[model samples]
Target: MMAAIATLLATTTALLFGAIGSRGGKEPTRNPEELVTVPAAPSKPIRTSTVRSQPSAPIPLANLPTSREPTSPQLALIPKPNAERESLLERRKQAGDTGILPGVGIPGGIPGAISEPSAANALVSSLGAGVRKAAAGQPDKAYALEQKDTLMAQGTSIRCALQTRIITDHPGFASCVVTEPVYSFTGKHLLLPKGTKVMGQYDAEPDSGRIGVIWERAITPNGVNIDMESPGVDNLGSAGHPGHYSAHWGSRISAALWISIFSDAFKYAGAKYGPTQTSTSSGIVTQDPFESNTAETIQNIAKQAVRRAANRPATVTINQGTIVSIFVAKDVDFSQTIKAH
Candidate 1:
């Protein structure tokens, strides 16, 4: 009886609890007005461009930045109005002038309303003056020719004779007497009269047989002195140019002296080889002999001679009355004669 009462008590407690739980377990009704529906947050979508988007519209001229204004000088480089430009072109065409259209073709196409001095023109002007000065002669120097004229032309020859003997041993100021009259191409006037002196100097080369004779000055029949720098030296007929002659004759003497010494050595050796009469116990015996010492002596002598020659100064002398031909190095204005100073 106690067990059954316990079970019955448990069942009554469970049924009481089940009824309270069922009432509490019911879902509550939602009123449409009271239901709070939260909307989703806003989102930005990603777009991939297949082709380029349209370019932005050009900014209106009025909206352009106006803070920077082109100055008058800068504006002068801009082209003028099209109608005005056409009129100017027409005028230039009528005038047959093709001068540069100042500032017309620049980026701004603004006509150079105000002309500015051209740097290029200034440069050209400076260069032209330089050319004129150069053509006249070096700066500050009197012109060689006052006008278009020549003292002598190319290939015109003048014959002159040495006034004094020119020796290769003593070089100094030497001159030549003009023996023959030197006439111009036309022969209307005498270029150099007889008795006129053509003066020059010889420069001796040390240790060299060569001597340099530079024709530098001239004296006219009236004793008028002149400089030869205006007219330069040139090659004469057959005698060759002064530069070549100076080198050739200068070295020739030295070479000839050496050649003669060697020749003498060979000659001596030949004479030694030749049969010679000898007095001995055996009567008149011809003997072949070699003299090494003699050869060495000859070489030593030659060397000593060369050394002595080196100590001697080279000289060139032109004998008096020897005709010489030379071309006038420059155009000389005989009328503008310079008196002897």
Candidate 2:
């Protein structure tokens, strides 16, 4: 029994060893949980000489064609012909060679061209001859000659009827003599109405020699007599109307006579009072103390009043007592005392 048991044990041990060797020979043993995987090495890209299958090849920026620099066109400087210069020189030569016409040599359009000792001598000769011839004739003929001479003298005076008529008929017309102030005064002063009719005559004074006429008129209501005289003859004929000798003679009287009288009255009033002041019914006051430069101030006030009056409704009437304040540049203020009704 012991031998038989030993044989079975040996067989069993040999079978176990054979089975272990078979399993080892069939596959290598490893732990699946601890198994490691390795990746293959990357491959290098292949270089090829084949052209792309599209259209044209792209041009390299450095190899592309460039634009050429611009060039200015050359110009030729040439001188122009001077036909006009030659023409002007010819015209000047022609003008220099020509002389003025006979009648035009003397400024007047008179018929005779006699050379006299002097203009004054010629005038005296004409007057004396005319007077002597008239005195030698019949009484009626002498009287007619005197009338004609008187009419001629009056027609040449500065205070001619035409000028006086213009002044009277159209006081506001620019060309009329009456548009400008005849007289200005500081206080309430009386003056002849602008269109008042007056007569003027020439007065020859040997001492205080003048060739102007005197205008005489009565101041209305006051009944004061006013007279205006013109400057000397030398100044008169220069006024362009030598034909109207009386008008030229009376020009100074017409322009300055009333102005002087008015200025005198203004001076008297100014001396009597301190300064002019005016007030409106609406309580607006204007002080006319003669500030150095009040013209601008007064102008600005008038402008503002005009603007305000324009903006007012149509129903509103611009009348006396209206109050208007003008604000000019900084620090300048003007208040107007309305005068128009």
The TM-score leader among the candidates is: 1
- Candidate 2, residue 218: CA error in Å? 4.9
Stretches of candidate 2 exceeding 4 Å from the true structure: 1-181, 187-190, 203-211, 216-224, 229-241, 244-341
Write the residue-wise lDDT of candidate 1 on 38-89 in tens digits: 9999898889878978999997766666665467886545555785677677
Q: Compared to the true structure, candidate 1 yields what TM-score?
A: 0.33
Highest lDDT model number? 1
- Candidate 2 residues 100-218, lDDT tens each? 22223355533222223346555665676688788887776333322221121222222222232212111121111221122222213213334333334332221121223334332
For residue 53, give model 1's deviation from the true position in Å: 77
